[model samples]
Target: MRTLTGVDSACSVLAGGCDSPVRSGDSIGVPMFVQTRAEGAYAFDESGKRFVDYVMAYGPLLFGHTHPALVRGLDAVAADGLVWGSTHRHEVRLAERIRSHLPSMERIRFTTTGSEAVMSAVRSARAFTGRDLVLKFAGNYHGHFDVALLDAGASARTDGGSGSGIPESVKRDVAVARYNDLDSVDALLRGREARLAAILVEPVCGNMGWVAPVPGFLEGLRERCDHVGAVLVFDEVITWLRLGLHGAQGRIGVMPDLTTLGKVMGGGFPIAAFGGRAAIMAQLAPDGGVFTGGTHAGNPFCVAMAHRVLDVLEAHPEYYAQMEALARRLADGLRAILRKRGLPYAVVQDASVVDFKFRSGPPNRNYDDACNADRTAYAAYYNAMLERGILLPPSVNEVMFLSTAHTTEDVDETLTAAEASLEL
Candidate 1:
């Protein structure tokens, strides 16, 4: 019999046994468990261990694993074929549905991934403004693309250099500012406003563990961008449908000139989009000069799943509230457990996401504060939870997600496991 030893050896055919760094276990202090199958709010590992899943496919499974509607919609759409490499009605309908909720998106463009959407948005902004410099907040991950990778989140290292092979010229065009702080943004723009093309932000700072913008912070970015003639781009990749139908911009009443959305929009498939004012989006190729195209940009299967997810959410907006309530319950339970155990920690809840930090003090307000999380303690706690059959976000900085499929009983069971885990 072949002894595989661990996940690393099992995934020998793949680089580092994972495509994404966070999926690996080198930093988490345990071998990454192999999940063989998943259902609504639960996943079973290769060993047949049942675990309550809070990872939720890293924030895309809003309706939970393998939703019946998604499965049915995709099944029906698959009969017509997956990709046509041409325009389709499903794409048009999805775009119209998204525009109905986000009026700021006067025109929209679909892409295969959030990174492509962001890259296109930046290209459009630069083309429209005839400027080069783009401002991004520290720890707000846009994607693995070169310009957006600097000062990215979800990395094991904190030197702010996400990965190698990025050119120095690309780094020069990008400037990093501290999240939730308008002063840092002002300082970066004071001497370079004329050359600034866009100010990209994750309105809710999901990458930094649900650190939302301080009051007037997003508004400040809007005003400054207007004053400087620079486009304001909100990277709502994680907060898109998860925050609300209108996204963070509509929920907070601070609209951006451009917005990028993904995750829940695909309903577990891979699809993302970016759109804004008509004049700006018109700069894309065939219409203007900036070029971006993918064979599977608006895949039929993905569009069908997105439409199904959106239809359910639009008809029953209360589902958002219910998910938030469950997340709040989980957060409250964590707080109670930590307090009773005299563990100094913070559990931050925003909508359907809950972020717990193994550190003493108030909730994290920015990337710097989020960095203070005790990874050692979190690793131990993560192992304990895993032992008890609860799968959380493997990374310390990642947020735990709640789905509509997660029931009250699941929350109670999680708390029970959490209590015992804390004692471990």
Candidate 2:
């Protein structure tokens, strides 16, 4: 194997030298190391430098990279075969397990990515209601799909066109509302009740950092959705098992009409699913009208990994508790360090997910507030931490995920590095 000097060699072949925009480190104007390997809570770059990883592959590695059980499960499945291209037992078993935990998902359909799961769920909502308009909260990203790319305008009232190549017709049918502000949603539903298909939101705001739902916010959305007959869709792709075994809806007690899940459910594999009431899910063909199909929708390897992920979650419920504790400890330590440095900072945390903003006041409640955070200060802190061999999410707007593999010692090491990093 040949090792490159920096991201330039990697970028020579790959666009931006990274698969994802966030991985590019262009936002922070820094060179992101090319990771060659990862195991447990650490990732190694091409230079063989090991950094304690807090990104955790952006929330898919609940058990951390190359977890022994996950690797073993995949090995077992590979021994049998990779893609059966037919309905498999593991897929059925995993669906049953998901439905058991998420009772709202009385029926489920598997997909290859979170984007597909969300797209299918939205399509189902439109079909079930026979409506065209779909409402999504600002900064609550569903995925990179056409419908999900629409943004709120400068007035924060008009629907801004797609940020990219999405069609105008598609953008016109979508509306953007302020997150955690139920009144904004109610206002949109009031005039468009007849045309409203669904209200899509991240139960806990993960994309714009970890801004959780305000008290009664989710319940309010549920009420509005029920009142307007719009399908309430919870995009729990990032929050699912990370919030609890039952997900944010289960922990918050505000169930949605349809739920999209990914990330931790895949156990580091590429798998995603969208499900809801039997009536709604039945709408998908070959049973009903809304078309959704993929060649590798429920491949055996991904299904086996998902099954093992669920099995681990069930057998050791203590993993959540331990990870949450570590998360809290890390948050508290960072908060103290920031205070000692006299820097204006606020740490927003939900269970094992944590994000810090370089602001003095209370944590951000919505997208606008998150945007107000000092990105320049965060970039300095990020580079400082990286120098100390502690890896954090490359962008300040992204959340740092803690996994079951992270130890108290890891948290302590992070804090020690943080204490020094804050000097920047």
Candidate 3:
């Protein structure tokens, strides 16, 4: 009924999406469909095709688009002042709110992107511990920092693996450990436990498409980190506010020494933060020595946006419950379709983050389970859904997100689309 010509053009412009050089980090994806634009739950491309959004800014648009609550918060803050080179009310308030969510945090610092927040956290760990090695999981993406560009150890590299040209020095300082496999991490630490500055993780792997920490895996890491005196950092940039007001830390109950936050914290705006024990955090800036500063680190627009976004999450903790119920409905509905078609499919998710593993059998428990899924089937399903008016994240490596804006009716319509697209 509608078309995605605009999505193509925009991606062309965004990717080359236009005429400019596509920078490595900033280019837009060739949308599965595009045209008019979007409001809440749905977007219309130039061709007027209506598609339900399954990619809510990669888990940031929790309350959906142009939310009145966010708008009001932004408007009120914006009217007061744009940016203060000095302290401001909203900044202190936001910090208090963030600390309240994760009582473990004694100090907090804001940045402009998830990458920056994570980078700062890692740097702080190195400073506080005086150790150089930073450990990260395969398939868990922390940011574009030279050290974090690693691929998961088991998954195929062709599907967005580690990049090249990084200094051997940088790569040497970083180590890649297997996801959900405690033995693998145990082995890495056996010989040189004291050298590790920090063990950075996603807690739930979204970059490799919705994998979660194995039971006892997190607590074990906590024990290991404490034994060796390394900081355990959770890169909750995507999972932070989406999982709960306190984010993955609150939901999973495995606290990290430091937490990096983004996505939902910004409410579709550019903002990120890292916080942890006060003494360790004091190692940053005028309080200590980390040598980092950003002119636009915490601009007014971002503060306004984040404060509004977070406040709403704080007010309606019930939203997370609603999102979880909706996610279960979608996951179960798709499983029924796979069963009906006699096709192999696995669904994975925690809270609002969900995905279909186009594999040969049952749902996977870790990255390996996800890698075993059927890529061809997923691509075909993706094309069919595009044709039908539902928008999903393009790459299998990314997890699908749900927002407060989607309704049961929308969920059912999506299920119908999946059934038809499955090819009986």
Q: Tens digits of per-residue lDDT for model 3 on 178-222?
A: 888888898877777889999999887777777777789889888
What tens digits encode model 1's per-residue C-alpha lDDT throughout 281-346?
999999999999999999887888788889889888999889988998999999999999998888
Between candidates 2 and 3, the TM-score winner = 2
Lowest-sum lDDT 10-residue window in model 2: 152-161
Off by over 4 Å in 1: 1-9, 156-163
Ranking by lDDT: 1, 2, 3
Better of 1 and 2 by lDDT: 1
lDDT values of the candidates?
A: 0.87, 0.84, 0.77
Query: Highest TM-score among the candidates is held by which one?
Result: 1
Candidate 3 residue spans exceeding 4 A from truth = 1-36, 72-76, 152-163
TM-scores for all candidates? 0.96, 0.95, 0.90
Q: lDDT for model 1, on a 0 to 1 scale?
A: 0.87
RMSD of 1: 1.9
